[model samples]
Target: MKIVQISDTHLTAAGGPTEEGFRLLVRHLDEDVRPDLVVHSGDIQVLDPDDTADRVRSRELLDLISTPLLVVPGNHDVGMPGLNAWAGITVTDARVAAHVAVFGPDHWRHETDEAVLIGIDSELLGSGLQREADQWRWIEDTVADLPVRKPVLLFLHKPLWSATDEPVDHQVDVGPVARDRLLGLLERIDLRSVGCGHLHRYRQVRRDRAIEVWAPATAFLAAGEDSLPDGRQELGYVEYTVEGGEVTAQFRLVPGMPQITTDDVPSIAQAIEAMTALR
Candidate 1:
């Protein structure tokens, strides 16, 4: 099966170059790839989690996909815990429920002919809430019953671990506390690969014997050390093909995609300060 993965679109309510690029990407997918399924890793909208307008526009863009589609929540989608309201908007149960009301559930499992695809919300991984515990239990149960012959593919908004030796950075990946438990649970399953986004740049890493593929943002250029080695901030998506029990990935760059420079991702302080000044 051919599956196209797109993440971190970061669409805003006001249509602009980013949206145009996404439109062009959709056209390319419809005309060129024509894959069997499309999966959006996360960050469907821009910053403000309460902005229903942004959600509406995001939904519209997603609706443009003619192929089978799946999605999971990102930090931007359900509100990142601890830092959720630091930017003046917290991730209440209502906020997460709203995503389900518009899109489907925040997490799900799909068993394809070749593999088992599991999606989870990265923001909730280390939250220590009842929901987090519930998801953990669900995951354990899911893995136990899965067919051992089929490899499992996991989807989330953040990487399980950036580098094996690097310390955990909650901002960039799953926190250590949750990561340890998650890795333990996953080791029991036949995990083949993991797909995630949030870094806004394409990268591939191997951790815990699973291939981790990071998808680039479709909206803007990532300005940071996480950029491509050649210093070219690429903007594109990832396409995966599962055939004969083997999986392969391809990063497809969108032609003529516009880019802009930013100091870095907006911090909680920056977002809060901007909101206060507006008030």
Candidate 2:
């Protein structure tokens, strides 16, 4: 299954470079790869609106998505809790409703002749505590029922844990409660791999028998000078090919756009080859 993962688009009602990158991404999906499915991890919008809350503003644009986009919301996409009210935008379960109206919902399971992909929403805005608890139970139950021998690709916005040991723009906010619950679930399931996007930079960590892969931000990146020549998050996507219980991938940055994929940018084929060795 050639499933693509794109994250952190930061699309605003007033689109700019970020929006351009999004269009580039959409074009790549519809033309280049024609992935089996496209999953957007989070932060699709910058969330600045005149009347409604930032989350709503972002969803308004999401409604215009040209492809089958599955998504979740990011902290920025929702705007800081209190800030929304002051901005005349309200943050509530309506956000999830709005998201579903545009990009589909919190979770989905798809199986083809190739692989089985299961997704979860990390964005818990409306009905916070209750929603999280419900989703947590569902995630565990869903994993528990999966066939271990078969490969299962799990998708979520925030990572299960830290992306790396280094300090970066990302943080492990899953908390002990969320972390423990998921780890416990993993202990019993044969999770082929997990893909996430909250952290802007690409980082991979392997714990237990599973690989946790963080998809890089689709929007502008933070500097990666000494360690990164691109110095920008650089827009990109994660493409996965799954067969049986084994998975191989290339976390490819869209290669053509000079503004996004530059000379330093890793080619799609190269990126997948790079991560193949990692797996």
lDDT of 1 by residue, 98-153 (tens): 88788798888999889889998877776667777788889889888888779788
Alpha carbon lDDT at 261, candidate 2: 33
> What's the TM-score of every candidate structure?
0.88, 0.73
Off by over 4 Å in 1: 83-89, 163-170, 226-232, 262-279
Model 2 C-alpha lDDT versus the unseen true structure: 0.61
- Please write out the lDDT profile of model 2 over residues 104-162, one tens digit for every residue: 66667666565667776655522254555677677767777777667677787777674
TM-score of model number 2: 0.73
Candidate 2: Cα lDDT at 87:
33
Whole-structure CA lDDT of model 1: 0.77
TM-score of 1: 0.88
Model 2 alpha-carbon drift over 4 Å, by segment: 48-67, 79-94, 125-128, 164-171, 223-233, 258-279
Cα deviation in Å at residue 159, candidate 2? 1.5
